[model samples]
Target: MTRRRRTACILAALGAGVAITQTACGGGTPSAAPSTSYDATVRADSPALYLSLGAGGPKKQKQSAVALKATYHHAPGVTSMPNGDRASLFDGTSQYVEIPDDDRLSVTTTGELTVEAWIRPDALTFAKTDGAGYVNWLGKVSSEEARTEWLARMYSRDNSEARANRISGYVFNEGGGLGAGSYFEDRVRPGEWIHYALVINTREKSDAYPTGYVKVYKNGVLRDQDALDGYDIVPSNTDAPMRIGTAAAKSYFKGAIGKVAVYDSEVPESRLAAHCRAMHGTPREAAGT
Candidate 1:
């Protein structure tokens, strides 16, 4: 089937809120749980952090069903999704969510990690001192000193060689200057709700590289990937806490952010796709895969 047709089918299934099952990459078939029930089912499979920006206002949003139950320091403003669900809106200048640093949220040199989010940006570019630039969707960095440990953000169209509105994933080791970081890239459009995921498999070594293999997915499909090899994307004990809608004071995202999840283990390709389907209001069985 064509990409357009496949996307249409997935959206249709999501709209119906149908629950379906599909086989995970490793083994047995796993059920595609609805977004509402995701915390219970998916979280049970592995330790994770789940944040649902639902009908309530930003101040009312809370971490759901996770062991740590991290709290969020949200800025003002609210927006509605296509489904009429409320989401937190960030205005490049100050709107963002700050989650305190936690050991569980940190990435290591030899473990799997996954970060996923649902976002819809008002504009791809935001104002900066030099020129217009993109913003970060989610990040974890140190505030003491300007250091980015790990983050998923849109590349600065005015400052980088990357294509306009491209999404990039970054990782840096502790005490390793920003130059010691590695990144992967993909593209995204503004004003549309999209599911973005970053999967890092540290257990598997790449033939051509030394670090972990990384994959970036959009709408449940892999779009870009690379190996961390020389760059250190993992964080040490001193790294900063994870934040949503911004990375420290800069790169504040200008958009409405919905569900954000962080998994300690790499999410299987099938399950990741199912989660994306659920976010769009469709059931996996209806995807016709």
Candidate 2:
């Protein structure tokens, strides 16, 4: 209404405009604030590589841990087998080649990682119920018989029939505060080849509400993804051999397995796709439904 008031109002509006522009350019007040950003990136080429094992590749057993190999042949640390076929599981009716110790694989990691393996489970073997039998950090246990393992699965444990045709991942920690983890089936489908992967986050401790986890992918789709909790801290330098098919039970896998790999880090989806593409056979359409 007055000349002075109109002049003051114009100055105020101009000042506000300047302040907003300054803030947008990150030059306003010197407030202590955290900032972040996101970017859309299209990678033309990736430098990452996948770890591969099994069938016609360099052998792991012949190089180190020969004694562990003996365990598979009904012998531990002893290299002699009467059968000319190196080693075989003879269950009276039939005999199939068990996974070789050289090929008995595992990866030692404490940060983050993705592990993929091709398994051909023998018929009639039921996987652990808690899905803890196969993929888990073997913790300190009175014996391998009573170890607490971690796992991931699609169906609810309460569902009576969920375990029937479901695929699951497992982690078991036992002995001296250290542990081992793995992946397995709720029900056994013998003579059929299956591809499985375990993804774990090691940075998050189990107590902090489980930042790490394991996921089971059958074929190409995810079947189960589970968090790691209710377990003790993973022991440092736990270099226990990565045993497939069976764990601690001498419950070895009976059948043909190829392209086994243990990676030092969790694998990404792109890397997983590349891995699946390199291997033989089509990825099964997500296990079960």
Candidate 3:
């Protein structure tokens, strides 16, 4: 080949290298998740952390919107997402991601917090991740004894066939480990994509929901509410790293996880529901998978 032609080809290859992975440059998939209508809404509110984990299966996606990167484990599979996007696939055994601890995660005082994720749990039966047989998916609890902050997880069939694959949102106190949790099972369809959310407001105290309260959502709709009896939050435990697809390194989630965001403030019900709607532009369907 001519010298000029060879030089041009090398430059062309280097230009495509901007993607997080080599596959993004050659594979048919695009390098990022498409923008959604709610992107503006989330951007306006400015969440403390937001991760678009499906940037063509990159080990890390630049957190341009919120400035947070994720470290993947065991090379989870990248699968085609329902909304014309891509997501990280967990083997239901040992794949997850971990983000370093940051001060912004420590939302204290009237511990207002909102955690959201778009997940498609596969049809396979997940094994026990914790003693309770629940696979913790996301949150701030570093370990079983590390400033137990909060985590979002799914129930394994080992706990109860009836409650298997259900979604639960739990929060705990920092030093001690007292906790409160709420769950929703109607949304557990082994093979479909659903937007899930957990909202907590600790402004007021209630005997039933003593430490505060938590609400679980499916496809942006409220499914259940429960108390977070962790004797008031111990702050957002800085020592505890922000984790996804697993909690306390005990429970690991299987299936696809994408489009994760964390806000240190309580989000309104209406807006929370809108987030799910904005993600998928299709007609509304029933909850069951």
Candidate 4:
């Protein structure tokens, strides 16, 4: 069977009354996903890279997008997803997926980009008090060997930046550190599937934000946005691996990562909302679609 012929995600909704519902492949019991698969939304977007955890690996994608097999550290397990599909589960302590970086994976400094995912975090807040009191769930991040580009990070219960359990989208100036950013104010509880997106547009600038702009979204709804002021978000072109469940394999994520997609251009808000609606079992005709 194909890699995508795995277990279905647990979420099943009847209507508005059942706002959130779930099912699981507990005990690692695998189920064959439908032939249509649950990743149609990511595929339809034609991203530079699309990781369908339920579909097995990169080769399973029609584009066969891989120059190397992903390296899984600490062996994150495959488990139930909230979207009626399976996902890669992380342990937060030492579990993550590392992809060899490439130019195709990096966007230009003055370009537009969108990185999105479906995730169910085990904890939105962390115990860490250092490194800005946050952890990177994914990004081309800073490390001793690599300069930073962009990141999708979560704040601790009391971080100096957000001061709450919040999600932040950031773009760095290639020097490999925290740069200009935006964040979502909502508290993300554990075990629930959430659609998270980071959209960056550097071609446009303003007086307050002379560099560009960044947007953060949750469950397809616009949460926050900000201007990039001091620095340009130029990709450092480092050999750092594009990672999930952690940025540089240090700030690990404890949860399940259902799907990941990267677009070279900023994805329109309507499209992101439609994708979110579909995963939520919402009708496609819900205003935007």
Winning candidate number (TM-score): 4
Which 10 consecutive positions of candidate 4 have the poorest summed lDDT? 23-32
Question: Which portions of model 2 miss their true places by more than 4 Å?
Answer: 1-109, 125-162, 174-189, 204-210, 230-236, 281-289
lDDT string, candidate 3, 15-88, tens digits: 23221111211112221223443455455666778876764333765576446677887677776544344578
222: Cα error in model 1, Å: 1.5
Give the alpha carbon lDDT tens digit for every residue of 6-78 in model 4.
Answer: 2122223223322343322111221223222335766777777777665333332233554444666666778
For candidate 1, what is the TM-score? 0.74
Steric collisions counted per model: 6, 41, 0, 6
lDDT of 2 by residue, 75-151 (tens): 21111011000112223122212332222132223365455554443434333322332222111112253433332
Candidates sorted on TM-score, descending: 4, 3, 1, 2
Q: RMSD in angstroms, all models?
A: 6.5, 21.1, 12.2, 8.8
Candidate 3 lDDT for residue 64? 61
Better of 2 and 3 by lDDT: 3
TM-scores of the models, in the given order?
0.74, 0.47, 0.75, 0.77
lDDT of 4 at 151: 79
Best by lDDT: 4
**202 Cα displacement, candidate 2 (Å):** 1.8
* Residue 78 shift from truth in candidate 1, angstroms: 2.7
Clashes in model 1: which pairs?
A: 13-282, 14-281, 14-282, 15-281, 171-233, 211-229
**Least accurate stretch of 10 residues (summed lDDT) in model 2?**
33-42
For residues 128-211, write the lDDT of model 1, one tens digit per residue.
Answer: 311235565687876543655667767555555545777767666665355222333444456677667877666777575466
